[model samples]
Target chain A: MQISASKWLDIWQANRRLTRRVIEAFPEDQLFSFSIGGMRTFGDMIKELLAVEGPGIEEIVTGVRQKFDEHASYQTKHELLDKWDAETARIDKFWADLPSEKYLERVNLFGQYESSVIDAILYFVENEIHHRGQGFVYLRSLGIQPPFFWER
Target chain B: MQISASKWLDIWQANRRLTRRVIEAFPEDQLFSFSIGGMRTFGDMIKELLAVEGPGIEEIVTGVRQKFDEHASYQTKHELLDKWDAETARIDKFWADLPSEKYLERVNLFGQYESSVIDAILYFVENEIHHRGQGFVYLRSLGIQPPFFWER
Candidate 1:
């Protein structure tokens, strides 16, 4: 949907900002509340999103799965937010350095069917949007107000 | 990009099946295991994916932020798999029901931005591929073997 390379970056940045705002809106105690029946807590969703930009993208670009710190802990909402901000910054640079033609080239995604780089990038944005919508529902179910959806 | 609507459906169906296989490959204990440090266990990621579909589609159909999850309980892995199967079926039916001109019309995705219906469909497939890639990484980290990348 985003035609230009710069447009992708813009969309990514907006998505990251929106996600961060939603994470910030939740109280610390509610972050890990997995008691919403079978739903993951808001904290859980944010962690998944944060990791996707760093470990997820790292694997995509390097063609190798990086061994992550299996015990890395985030004690506070700030820790998650910090990681979210840092990874977005890293992704912005990654996008800046990426050539537009690279988007059309197919890459081995986890040894699965080869997918074009453009489709992969779109996947990244769409995945975040999907999760962010979940975070909104979690927030409302917890009686917390989510950030304005259009801030992005 | 897949120019034909049927071509996009074919790809989307393939991507959904791959996700289903990856979800089936993991054990029950790790579904919610965020214990792997920076990684989101397969369970959490799958829930996020399932939770987003209704709202995401609602966004595409409506121009405003629809109420978030007025009626969704957190679904189990089996429940999620059932959803994945149902969505794939629903998508095929929805695609068949559409007129040719709807593919070219720009639709509002929850007021986030405007995207053509075709681009929106492409976005769905790409999102599944990205998360399935993460599932593979999680599987490998846990010393489990993922489904063959090209078995489909």
Candidate 2:
């Protein structure tokens, strides 16, 4: 059975809760430490998450692709949290207003001609988990236990 | 700068490597245990990853999502590896062919108005990391140390 838009919204809500909880687990001081080289620090990844989605959404609505600079200012945990709340709310509204039939419509995704609306939504949740996983590792490396595992 | 599609592909390749290596490090019998209730068993999570992405991609393409049965055919680590490899190959090919401009296009994602293709691609990579992080906790709960953190 194809997942309907409403189910996708529920998933998004669950994911938002998980992601926010994960981000909040770390002490603000360690957010930027290089627990490992090459991979982004936990804080950097959080910043990246905040920076990317809104601009990406803007690009889609306007049909214009814009360059995202890595060094753009996203300095504080509070800012990231605020942005996360705003972006998720915006996304939720977007999903709520979406028509169900478009879920099957193919769209170009980063040069690939494959995407159902639901797949994109699933990816949104999945991507956060991937990076936050790194954050979890960072916490462990510092000998700071992350929030209880199921707290997500 | 806007990330090239190849950047995402490269990241995904690296992510798969990291995730698999994590799995490989686990003792076979302990794969299903976790300290957190409702925390997906490591094996169960891996199966979910495999089961979801391919069929999810198929759903994205054809607009028909399938309900996944609780048990996947692969009970052994080797079987899971095989499925993971095969599915990775499939996704790589589909992604490699993606047209770069579509990254900015709006398209329906699970009945949502449409997210930028770039966000979708980012979501794919990020989602993997998110779950893989959970897998890491499961590893630690077993008192089993994981591989070198930066191998990816």
Candidate 3:
């Protein structure tokens, strides 16, 4: 009944793909300035995702926990997309390298999240979808149609 | 390192609890009428979750597919909270009845989604988080602060 690593990767990839589409739907001017309540802008939320997932997955692979940091600079939407593309590759590379059983092994992720790799990854994917949902709301408020959820 | 059904239930319960909090944070007037672009209101979104999860779990337990239908009448925020509580119990009842191996079995969920029970459940959890994220944005737009997401 255990889900294989490949299946987990597929789930992660689908969620990330959808999130990327959500990011692309954001208007350039609104991406960083739009805020709901006191929540960080969509741009800031995306940075948090970039900061967390890539390093979290990499640490899961290397068994070396690094301090949580927003590693890459994100200035323009294009830059964000570029870095997002790079991080996409990073996920495929490191996730492919992981031994299947390692997914079931628990790790203290980034000294913050402590769970098995699979659960940790689920948390990662769900977190992105959660934020992207915010972006969807933002786009709708701005009169833009956010991408469909199932398109990913 | 395989996750037990109990663990998955724990994850589901935590998510549902947080979602219930998100529901509580909504202003009465905004729950049903607020829409960004053309998306459903928060009330509609929560009803979808209520419709899906309780019955989805029941379907898995009985191996009988049922059409997706919104079961509860949610007129007021209090009614919504009441239904949420009932659905929480419904999940526990059906989920507890399921055999552990059923977690790996595939069901044609609502005659739509075709995936293993675990994936279906994960989809259920993620979908709620996604919509709740939308509600968070709505609250923010109304200058209302959403309940902290991590409180779960």
Q: Please rank every candidate by lDDT, starting with the best.
A: 3, 1, 2
Each candidate's root-mean-square deviation in Å? Answer: 9.4, 11.1, 2.3
Q: Model 3: residues >4 Å from true position, as ranges?
A: A100-106, A112-116
Model 1 residue A25 distance off true place after TM-score fit, in angstroms: 0.7
Give the per-residue lDDT digits (tens) of candidate 3, residues B28-104: 98898987778888999989998899889888888888779774567899999998899899999998888876777
User: For candidate 1, lDDT tens digit of each residue in A21-104?
Assistant: 988887888777633335456677667666555655555566676554423577688888888888887787666667665656
Native A-B contacts reproduced, model 3? 0.68
lDDT of 2 by residue, B63-92 (tens): 454554437867788888888899788777
Per model, the share of native interface contacts recovered reads 0.01, 0.29, 0.68
Clash pairs, model 1 backbone: B59-B110
Worst 10 residues of 1 chain B by lDDT: B66-75
Between prediction 1 and prediction 2, which has the larger DockQ? Answer: 2
Best-performing candidate as measured by DockQ: 3
